[model samples]
Target: MSRKLDPRVVRTRQMLRDALVELIHEQGYEKITVQDITSRATLNRATFYLHYRDKLDLLYQSSKEIVKDLTECIDLSFEEDKEFDFLSDKPHIVFIRLFEQVSQNSNLYKVFLTEKNMPHFTSRIKDVLVDFILKGINHVQPDDQLLTVPREIAVRYFAAAFLEVIVWWLEKDMPYAPKYMAGLLMRIAIKGPYVNNPF
Candidate 1:
């Protein structure tokens, strides 16, 4: 059995998270403190202590929520489909939705992802992508004997490529629309590396 968190508590935590992200952008993650977060959130120290022990605790929880939203963004786009349609434009649709999620929350991602001292947050996102890709690979090709490359290496390669594109997108302030970026990623995913593609 499980219990739902109070709505007030949930709202408070989100406010704190948003405040922390704002402060992180202004100063940096390593320099921000719990007091700074609470002050920016317009809440007091006692209220902050009631929810999180410290700034780092808030950071981990905030980053986890972002990753959860990203996972749900991708998952909800394909919940009705039991089988993947490789021949169809399904990859583009899914990637567009995923990128839309990031663009919608671009500020938080721009700060946490680009920050120098936030490797933990970045790694958590990569871990999510790696797990998602690994599961898909296993589902599509269940037989290990048929694999040309080690499963771990292949999965990491795909995950790193996806992560790098996302970072680049953020760095460039998402000059390309989500759908356009999705099409590019889908092509690379289906046709191997960009250099080998006929396009």
Candidate 2:
């Protein structure tokens, strides 16, 4: 049902996105102009305008693409009929794929996640995680009697903690491998701070 995008258009947009990433790294998002992006992309102002209204428009669209890719990664990892086990020692495929997605796009993630100036993008990422967690909780159907805290609060807490840890991993140059990080996240989610130690 969806129309196919022209290859030329796709290539041009990728160039613009790449240029934006490079410019953001060199200077910062606030200082980048449309001219800077076009120049970096080796394209002209007219061509740039044909695709986007302005730098912000380009940023929003590029970010949407990244978010879409991440969503797809998570979606693909979920098996519709199979329930995911949270207490298992093994890392979930969803977490593994999520980490792999971030690792593959580390540069873009570092810019988006660690940049204090880009709170909008950071919040967008959190929203995605929150939505995923809510859906996951519904799918798992845990008994309400066992939960000491409110479901919404727990969901938000987990989402925020997961996002912060990812930001830390990125800022620290990802010393751990994606698979290892995935397992660590699973352990933390299952046992909280008591993952390896027992009281």
Candidate 3:
């Protein structure tokens, strides 16, 4: 069995993560320092050091945590008993949950996705999406004859498009609700851009 984390430890880590995110928005990642994070978090250097070695370590751990949460959310959509029909009019639960998660954590995502200095973090998100797509393809077991292009190419294409759409949605201040976005993505995924036209 897994050990439960102390509530105090969780709160301190969240504060540090929030401070780092705020600092990244106000200035940028490269300009922020360990002292800057502690100051913003209203904690001292010793408390910060107790959890993270430096700002980079904090950023990395925070990013990984976010990605892990996302993976868990996505994994729920693939539960064996849940029948997810991509072609159905209804949006997949995974997309709804994924978008909701992103909306809830918009600030952190905006910093990770838009900041030029955090390409590695952005790439990590993309990698998660790619893995998600691969699992989906494996689970669904679509006809091989239907796929004209290589599976790897198709997976990357969908993953990149999904990631870009997220960046666009966040950049635009999330004009649409998460459920609406989820439905839209489901529609697009089921029927490509030229739904009525011949390829």
Which one wins on lDDT?
Answer: 3
Candidate that scores best on TM-score? 3
For model 3, the superposed segments whose C-alpha errors exceed 4 Å read: 77-83
Residue lDDT tens for model 2, 1-199: 9999999999999999989988898898999999999999999999999999999999899889889898888874244638666777778788888899999989888887776577888888898888877766666656776777888998999899989989999999999999999999878776776736675
Off by over 4 Å in 2: 76-85, 195-198
> Candidate 1: where are CA atoms >4 Å away?
75-84, 89-93, 143-147, 193-199
Sorting all predicted structures by TM-score, with the top scorer first, yields 3, 2, 1
Candidate scoring better on lDDT of 1 and 3 = 3
TM-score of each: 0.83, 0.90, 0.92
Model 3 RMSD in Å is 1.8
Model 2 gets an lDDT of 0.85
Task: Kindly indicate the candidate among 1 and 3 with the higher TM-score.
Answer: 3
Point out the higher-scoring one by TM-score: 2 or 3.
Answer: 3
In angstroms, give how far residue 134 of model 2 lies from its true place: 1.7
